[model samples]
Target: MARTPVLAAGGIVLRREAPPRFAIVRLRKRNEWVLPKGKLDDGETPRDAAEREVLEETGHDVEVHEFLGTLVYDSGGRSKVVHYWRMDAGGKPVRALMSDIREVDWLPLDEALDRLSRGYERVFLENVGPIALQAAANAERERRTRLRVAAAERRRAQPAEQEPAAGAPVIAGARAADPAPVRPAVTPEYAAADAGEVAGREHVVEVTAPEAPPSSAREIAPIAAVVQPTPRKNLIERVRDWLRRAA
Candidate 1:
């Protein structure tokens, strides 16, 4: 009869760096460097167990993501099964090392693989390391993209300044000059019409000689005598005058 496999869970915790690093722990009793993991507690789900175990072993808080893969191996006379999930650790450890862990070290994939005392773990990291790093890189890119979009939105939200009208004065150190007073322009025809209207309103005055002042004194001088008319000469005289002329 086949025996039931001993079930365990753990994390492949990654710390973000220039080239990312993976977490591995040294065992207290066996004195071997291995992936941080432990067997499941009674009634605990595999995912929760994976998070708890990683925290206890690595002494760093982690955010767990996708499931990596399973490792099936032999321990004593029983088959062992360990499930793993990809996780991200912060920059610094938040707690002390767990009693079962002598120390925890973060290393690059190749070095982490070589550092593991178990062959199965080395092979597992070899397969899953690229996947975890890629996921981290993709997430970082998405974060930067969101930040850029948010900045663009903030720029759009601000009010735009109104541009001054063309030909308007731009003063350097004082308020803009008040606009020049505008005069209504008139055509020559209108100016001529206005002049005619003013000329038409002029008045013409007629001055008669003033009446002679009343005579201050009564008239005293008599009128001069009129000359008498000449009398006609008698006919005889007229004849004698003619005879004389003849003689």
Candidate 2:
């Protein structure tokens, strides 16, 4: 069986500030600050592999912003391509594990350039650094724009009041400004529909008369006593009585 190409991934180490910064991890044996990366597993894309590798190596979760570039170099006569990305790590860098990563640190833009391996520095400066700077600039511009718009709205709502001069317009245009009109209070009739009383007070159309009290025993007629006839004893007794009468 032919050996499969080793797919790997990792991330740019980040420095947190008003505008974030990027750096790389220093592997123990290699002893170089390079972008955190590892090989992809079966069915894993390079992007997913990169994110996982960065988190594993750096202990920093990051949002991948964009693909920076790719590195294609020969490894043992087989070509390997390492995909790079610009990411936002969202906070301070902390060293989590010591086995794979010896130490993790945040370097300023210029200092990061000094620390990264010469082989990868070209990629960092040419691709990743510029992209990160542009993103930071864009974020700053958006922040300033939002602040300006909010300040303008505040000023418009409540402009500074001027001291009244002897001949200055008496009301300062304040009274002339119309107050927001108050809506009239709703009456019970208008609200009655929502209350399920649309038929207006459910008028008792059929006023049934109250039932009379049950009659007392004194007012009721007495029940007559019931007399039951005595039953004859047997057929023999009946026949004897009939014969005697006949005789």
Best by TM-score: 1
Q: How does candidate 2 fare on TM-score?
A: 0.52
Per-prediction tally of clashes: 0, 8
Give each model a TM-score: 0.67, 0.52
TM-score of 1: 0.67
Q: Which stretches in model 2 have alpha-carbon errors above 4 Å? A: 1-4, 18-20, 93-95, 121-124, 143-247
Model 1: per-residue Cα lDDT over 50-150, one tens digit each: 99998888888899999999999999899999999999997777888878889999999988998999898898889999999998899889999999999
Misplaced by over 4 Å in model 1 are 165-168, 176-247
- Residue pairs in collision within model 2: 7-40, 8-38, 8-39, 9-37, 9-38, 10-36, 10-37, 13-23
lDDT accuracy of residue 140 in candidate 1: 88
Predicted structure 1: clash tally? 0
Q: Tens digits of per-residue lDDT for model 2 on 1-247?
A: 6555556766664555744566567889978777677888889998998887887777777788667677766667676678777666747545475488887767677777777875655554656676767875676699899999999999999967977778854532344344433232322221222222232333222222325642443222222323333343455665676688879
Give candidates' CA RMSD values in order: 29.0, 31.4
